[model samples]
Target: MCNARGDEAQAVARLGFLEWAFTEPGQVTAETVKDALRHPATKAPGSAAARAFVDYLRQAVTPLSAGRARRGRARALH
Candidate 1:
């Protein structure tokens, strides 16, 4: 029915917005991203893809202190 279709469309739009918030340069902070992940809109059944994207962002932004330390060691050797 038209109502079901409309709901699906709205869910898709919300997923797109969340994706942009997670991936776009400087659009959102890690805490904001976490909050968005917990939001009901993001938790909709149709939002699995968007949820995965935000999860990827969460892992990608994890502190890189170990990597930085290795880079510093390499630089010291140069």
Candidate 2:
């Protein structure tokens, strides 16, 4: 996910999210992700920019997560 557009703060946030998501089983909820985004350490670099970046990430990831959940359920039924 690293790219030129992603500055150090954004990279740190993303890494933190990944760590949180993988550290525990079933810990990747929207609320948890938002919590990580708003975390003091993660937001310390630049609150406004981090907030905006996280908002964008929320919009993009939420639907994909929902869709994945739905697909997992569908597969279970079959």
Candidate 3:
């Protein structure tokens, strides 16, 4: 009853996951995302959409971290 589609609990959990994507704790490492994926709430019915988003989030960070690492290595060369 919390929203038009109901399943308020799942919705709240999903919102938490989304918020984690941009928060300090969530940005730690791949393990953080993995833990979120393993969370029971993430497996709820509406999760079909979360897969792509999670994948995108996972993929999006790869290059950014890599680039930073690359720059750090380059700086060391100087």
Report the number of backbone clashes for model 2. Answer: 0
Candidates in order, TM-scores: namely 0.38, 0.36, 0.35
Q: Give the lDDT ranking, best first.
A: 1, 2, 3
Residues 1-78, model 1: lDDT tens digits: 112344565565566666676676765777766765676754544444445454554564576569888989999999
Clashes of 3: 0
Q: Mind giving the per-residue lDDT tens digits that candidate 2 earns over 1-78? A: 333244765566566546646784775676766666566645543454454456555663565448788989999999
The alpha-carbon RMSD values of the candidates against the true structure, listed in the order shown, are 8.2, 7.6, 8.3
Residue pairs that clash (backbone atoms under 3 angstroms), model 3: none
Weakest lDDT window of 10 consecutive positions for candidate 2: 1-10
Off by over 4 Å in 2: 1-6, 27-53, 64-78
Q: lDDT (CA) for every model shown? A: 0.60, 0.59, 0.56
Candidate 1 global lDDT: 0.60
